[model samples]
Target: MLPHDDNPLFATFARAQIRVERGEGVWLHTSDGRRFLDFTGGIAVNSLGHAHPHLVAAITAQASKLWHVSNLFEIPGQERLAERLTEASFADKAFFTNSGAEALECAIKTARRYHYVNGQPERYRILTFEGAFHGRTLATIAAGGQKKYLEGFGPKVEGFDQVAFGDHEALAAAVTDETAAILVEPIQGEGGIRAVPEVCLKGLRDLCDEKGILLIYDEVQTGIGRTGTFFAYEHSGAEPDILASAKGIGGGFPMGVCLATAEAAKGMTPGTHGTTFGGNPLAMAVGNAVLDVVLGEGFLAEVRRTALLFKQSLASLADRYPEMIEAVRGEGLLIGIKPRVPNGAFIEALRGHEMLAAPAGDNVIRFLPPLNVTPEEVREAMRRIEAAAAELSGRPAEGAAEGAAA
Candidate 1:
């Protein structure tokens, strides 16, 4: 039962009716004293899991030192974090934001500005793909070109062209002389965890290079070791001129970054664009702490190991419960399962069994476990999933016999 009071919240979110009291590691405890295995990881934001001592300590230390300072002034923590980020990746420069949406906005602006400053002011249109989720800003919504998101938002933002998700021929045909850049997600997390093949990514890179256009990768969900790699672009060998990363970058802190090559960022002069709270000391502290753990010795390799173990279990579950699951897809910890049943019902079933999962496009359920989830917890998650399957299919439980196979 939901609380009956004068609720001041907006109706935008169709939220779960439970109130979480606390979260620790891989579990969330509700106000009613129910414990749930939180595989959602706060929709892929809790990279280091809940109440991580390192993250908490970083925040505490930074709060005690300094909380924020205008971008007009020098911020040592922000400079240090930027250096750390650039040291690990291909970006020659980095700009901070408060969320993935703003990072994407900066990426878009950077692309157009690059062409403008390069004397190709006509090359302002960006070629975007279908089934891509960029962000909620007006420009980003137009980039996605989804009617559901753009509905009632009259007069869509200009300078964006849409193409089918994996159709290289269509993409090539769609590009014109005025194209400024091509944008895509290496792994479409919200679009049912659909991974653009390595070959396709390389093809996009080739196309952009041939056309003298910038290549942008929206790694907001696939970055920060979510997909077994530091960035999904690493798996494809297709580096972007500009990259947008968030969700896991702050290990639950609200922060995002736009990474760009030296050439791509030439147009963003000191006053061209800025954010007040983008690189504040508090967020930078958490971001640096997250990078310390993610880019540490053998940390990503361990994440890959754990992801493989968990993915194999999911594949086993799909094989055993064909009536409930149609397919298992995605890379690493960003796994998606296309279920034969309604996605909403499946999510609710998981919830009923003391587990939490997120719904994605194309009737898929996403399992975003913590990067450091123990093997025992992975097995337990599988057990609960099996139980949910049994309940959904109206069959007697065979989980004990099937758990070993998983």
Candidate 2:
């Protein structure tokens, strides 16, 4: 230990004991050489699983040539990735960032810019929803409207107001003349896996239309085929004017994207917004590789079919453990288990069963296995969950639920 053992600069997360060494597919190896099934999938970042051949090749190829370059030059990888992103989704333009928070920041900027460019500078307020998880940035934390994360962050940023997550009436009331947009997650990943109803997204879209406000979906955890579709809104058939994407975008690499229509992006002039490492060749190459795998022939369809198996399996588990595991929610592989016991207990119980799961807000455990997880793997995961449920039922000694890994 250093002479000053308690360096205040370090974060509280240093309490974690395990040090992961390597991972492949759905298995992670810790420094102690214990193998664990990675149902968390790095909290849904490793969509293709750890060290996938495609991602490895992309990173290696890019590393051998170029790793970092300023955004001044015309990077081929960025252009290609931008084209792919715009083509795959309902976006006319794309802005790259290095993380989810940055993407949300860019989305907020784009939304306000949309109104500003259209001669409505007063339309700067962004209306977000309660239980929403945007990101860790100051603006994003304020925009998220989750009180737990806002602690000690004195004086929240302005231009953000929030209402009930699914209350359309409160949402409508929140949108005033100065409201720039309504931002939400199609599925609230960190908010206990609560999914906004399709009707809710549709209503928000209609509201945006009537009020001439922009709509933004924080798809950081639900995008990149994490849901049944490439984007969750595809299932609802609702589109957003501005969208923030990250997490699984680069499979496991640090990559994010803020997408918008050309009209909404007009205010993003040359000097308006910028990120040095956003569109670096390395990130773009990895993002392209991820896109290639997710958009491959029938890959997404397999995700849907596998999701069906997972949902059915979790539902059956819930049936068996009526006193322990209750309801199952979320879309595609982004599944959650609302346990009768504390969700953290289930997470710890699964550790002994050689499986790992992430806990979300509220008393829920997220089964965010990789998108490429096979049916057999899903069954195995369910078996582990059932076993964990049985074990957790016996553990009356431990109290308090799981903390969110999301």
Candidate 3:
């Protein structure tokens, strides 16, 4: 055995035991030539699916022209992307970063600084929701306040107050005079695909407005058309003063964006915040490509249509295997399967059937298929899921097939 055979990389991630060589569309290929239907979509990062021609062309074209430059200089691609982002959303200004963590960091800083410069320096605390995942950064982890991610990370960063998820009374009570903002995920991606109800989101907006506090949405996992809209906030009709977006924004390229209203961004002066490698030409090029596809006519409508079909199919599957599946949750293509079996075992069963899925909190298995996934692909995924469930039940494939035909 080689020295690297044991553990060459950090032991942080419990990666699936598959060695992926390349991917195209919704399929992953192993070095040994095995193909797996990938429903994870790289944890919702592959917005346009793997190796999308437009994204590839954009990245290659930019690679041939310009790549990285200091943020001190003006970047036309960044400016164009920022313009497109702001124009398509409720934001008036945009800031770029390399990942969702940095985006959230910018949002946290922007919220605090907004209060600071507005003569309310004491209102630095941010109220966050339980089961919400912002990122892994110290500030974001502290904002999330999940003990699993906060363990042994030293004293938790201050100014983050956590309230029970979706408890309007608790949220209202948690807010103090020191609260500068309320940060939340429109759809709790890692918190088992729990989407906050529209009423609750509107209530949060009302609370923030009443308290003179900012409202921030961490749309990292649910943004960029994953939820059949440009951002998940669109579903609730509640607009945030600041929004953090990443993941699918660059179509698998590393990128993050912090969008804010002009009033909310008053404190983000030249020296207040900056990034070195963010919004590079390469990342901006891919980001533009992703926008071209996502913002195209009929694209998001098709995503909604496809998501409805997928969700109905999943609902039928759950009905058929009630003993195996507890429920199907989530919106658009970001789905979660709450199974009666252990989520890890359920995911392994899907892997055994050569299908990829992601595991989430609360024993949920996430299905983050690409936004452009075809209707045929959704049907195929349902078949594979049924097969996996049958396998788990120790039943022959034909038995399940006959029952389905009935």
Candidate 4:
């Protein structure tokens, strides 16, 4: 048995343990029977909320029929999901994976291979921005270009260069003959819910076009209707040679996919790279179920409408308590509140009101409620947030007579 706060094989995450027993749309129930509004969305992994009937039905049905088979066998679910992804984006090919890190790793290899196939093996470097969070793999830590994550790891991986977030000239100057690709996240999630400027996205597309270097967008956090769009890149029409998608792709299930243009995919042949458990029937079936809801008629449109309502509500909240929340940023359900105080303090205050939010870098608290969260839920959440802000900052509870300033 595991002692309090001590696990033999599992590392402790933050400082809390809920032992969540069940979850439904936008609400999680702990083993003690307390309910909390889950704005964290499993840190943006639960795209369709928890325990959706369709996802449960599909996974249950598939699990009963067949759980998994080696990549050596044909899988119809993979076929349909791949076709759906390509149809929705500029990609001509796709490769499945079990997580976002693996998807990004494949993208890196594919980008390098593109250069090698073009007779430029020396083009191995990838230009990534600082304050970016890609993943935790050895190569990804290098690609993220963050020193904090790489502190304990010795002898950093080679061929990664860091540049300023929106500096076009600095980014352009960083690119050299050795540069094979430019990797960026459409929205930096973990590093903070920092949205890449549209001008910078388009400028990178233009620069990559002129230099013949591949452009890769890591949509692991912003994809699958998180930002009220099928893909965050669609917001700017800045298509990349390769795009990595995960997190929300499988609703709550684990799945990741790398979408690449035909030219880029050409570098990845049958024997060049593969994963045995990546495209198994179980994952594919869940992926299909997720896509069915995400790509369904009027589903995303409703999400966009909800996004507008959420913005109005959040703006009002910010206006009411100017000290606790500095500004509201980000798009869709993937909203971020730049806190005047520490984000950790804000999250702690939220716990008192039974609202759960995830903390990000740069003093930002990410609000990632389920994509299908209703207006009533949003209004209720706003009330709790107002109360928390008032309590945390010692401000008047919104229109209370005691503190008329609110």
Candidate 5:
């Protein structure tokens, strides 16, 4: 064994102590035989939860047939998925990718190419909001504009400008003759689950139309039924010309896609852009399987109903534990709680109670349970949360002392 302090892999993520062996539904089983209630849902990627039967069967079936094939050959799964995605959303064309970052990259390229084909090569700059988390790529990090992520990364990529979020005046002022697109997340996932109001989204659509620039949505976290809708933009009635999607798109599988209107993608002809592993048979199979569940009859309605129940419970919990939780926020299953104590402390407390959550910007703890989570699961999570809050507030849990006495 290596030294306790040494690791062979890059020391990037501040990983938790437990070693997860396997998972099923909303629980993670550790190597030590401990089962934890999983609320992070693989950072909101496990839409149907861990090891969903449908996903498992699809992947297994695909593996037995073809694991991978070059993008040069036609893949029927990709064609079918693309058709379904376009029929369901505002896009008319879709480009497959392996991750959210690649989708964003493709979106950025599509927007610039659209302007170039329109005979305006200089109109390449894209406007983004402050407090956004696009991705970790060189271009996406530049678009996110967070100083911490950009720090030490030499010479930030050019053509991206940032403005105060929700500030119509600043956003308008920031737009210029060189602007090619306005990219935003309907709900900022890593930015403390901040949502752009419906009116603001409409205003953005109007702004883009008035300026003849494309509107791009980085829906990597808010799409695929996480926001009580097929895509969060549907809630606002402001359809984007280009959108980057990932996270739950493939349930637990690694996949992403960039969707665009036919006009927006007109410039991306043969040989302009391509990916070697994107749209592979395996990824396509899983993507199709995920859609099979997400698009099933009444599935999205159930997600909305469950989200309402969970958020109401969280609101009540915040009211009861004002000393521990400051507020509740977010839409659908993508919920966040602002803690009275440090967010890290609250996360650790939850972990101690055998519950898992993720931390976001602005000191918020995210509770991203699987979209198919049941009401009983939500109630169980609340019980653990109450216990954690009681401990932090120096109060005995509701029945803990009584149980001990008995």
Candidate 6:
């Protein structure tokens, strides 16, 4: 075996030490026989949690028939998935990809192309929020406008402008005649679960309409019922001309989609864009299976109910341990807690309690549980969180003193 410090893989992520053996529902079983309640949800990718029977059966069935066939041929599954997605959203067309970054890239291209077709090729610049995170690709990193992700990536890509997050004056001032679109995330997941106000979303749509520029929403993390709605934008009442979605869409499968209005996609004619392994039969099968569950009767309502309970529980926990938790933020199952203690320390403490969570910017710990997470699971997570808080505050857990006396 490789020495602990002599790994062949690139040292990019500060990965945890736990080795997972398998996962089922909201629980993960580690190689060392430890069971962990999973709230990270594979960074919001596992919509239905690990080993969902429907997803597994769909992929398995598709794998037996066809695994891959390039975009050259007309894939029935891809067409059906696209049709369903467009029918459900504000888009008339859909383009498939393999990751959220690709979806954002495609959305960017579609926005620029819309202006290009109108005989204004110079109007290619796009405006983004200061703390936004589009993706890891060079173009997307530039679009995100985060210096940390752009620091070592050589010269930043051109034609992207950024404005202070939620600063309406700055956002309006940044828009120029050359701007093709304004890109935003309805709920900023990586930026610490910060949600844009519904009023601000409507104002952005008005500005885009008045300026004759398209509005693009990067719903990579907030789409596919991660939020109470099918898309977070559904709560804002402002529809984007283009939308980029991934993450939970495939329920852990590697897939993405860029949806666009018919008018916004006018320039994407033949030879405009394409992909190789995107929208393969395997991915389409999984994506469809995910939709079958997410769009099922009363599924989204259940998600809303569970999210409310979870958030209320977290709020109460924060109230009880003000020294450990500063604030509870976010919508639906995509929640975050700003802690008085260091986020890393809190995350470590939670891990010690056999509950997995993810760290975010702004010194927050995110809890992205499955949409179908049960009330019992929420209570169990709350117990673990309270234990973590007690340990962090240097106090014994609820029953620790009684157990010791016994």
lDDT of candidate 6 over 1-406, digit per residue (tens): 3455798887787778889999999999998999999999999999999999999999999999999989889899999999999988999999999999999999999999999999999999999998899999999999999888999879999999999999999999999999999999999999999999999999999999999999999999999998899999999889999999999999989999999999999999999999999999999999999999999999999999999999998898888788888999998999989999889999898898899999988998999999999998888888888888888898875632232211
Q: List residue ranges in candidate 6 displaced over 4 A.
A: 1-5, 398-406
TM-score of 5: 0.97
Off by over 4 Å in 1: 1-5, 399-406
Question: What shift in Å separates residue 146 of candidate 2 from its native position after superposition?
Answer: 2.1
Superposed Cα RMSD, model 3: 2.2
Q: Between which residue pairs do clashes occur in model 1?
A: none
TM-score of each: 0.97, 0.94, 0.97, 0.96, 0.97, 0.97
What does the lDDT read for residue 321 in candidate 4?
76
Which candidate do you rate higher for TM-score, 2 or 5? 5
Candidate with better lDDT, 1 vs 4:
1
> 1-406, model 2: which lDDT tens digit per residue?
2334675656644333557899999988998888888999988999999999989988998899998879988899988988988998999899999999999999999988878888899999999888888988899999987787899999899999989867878878888999999898999998899998898889889999999999899999999999989999998998998899999998888889999988888899999999889989999999999999999999999999999988987787677677887799989999998998787777887888778888888798998999999997776676667667766676421111232111
Candidate 4 overall lDDT versus native: 0.89
Q: Give the TM-score comparing model 6 with the true structure, all chains together.
A: 0.97
lDDT of 1 by residue, 162-277 (tens): 99988888999999989999999999999899999999999999999999999999999999999988999999888999999999999899999999999999999978999999
Model 6 steric clash total: 0
Return the clash pairs for model 4, or none. none
lDDT of the structure predicted as candidate 1: 0.91
Candidate 6 at 77: error in angstroms?
0.6
| Angstrom error at residue 360, model 2 | 0.7
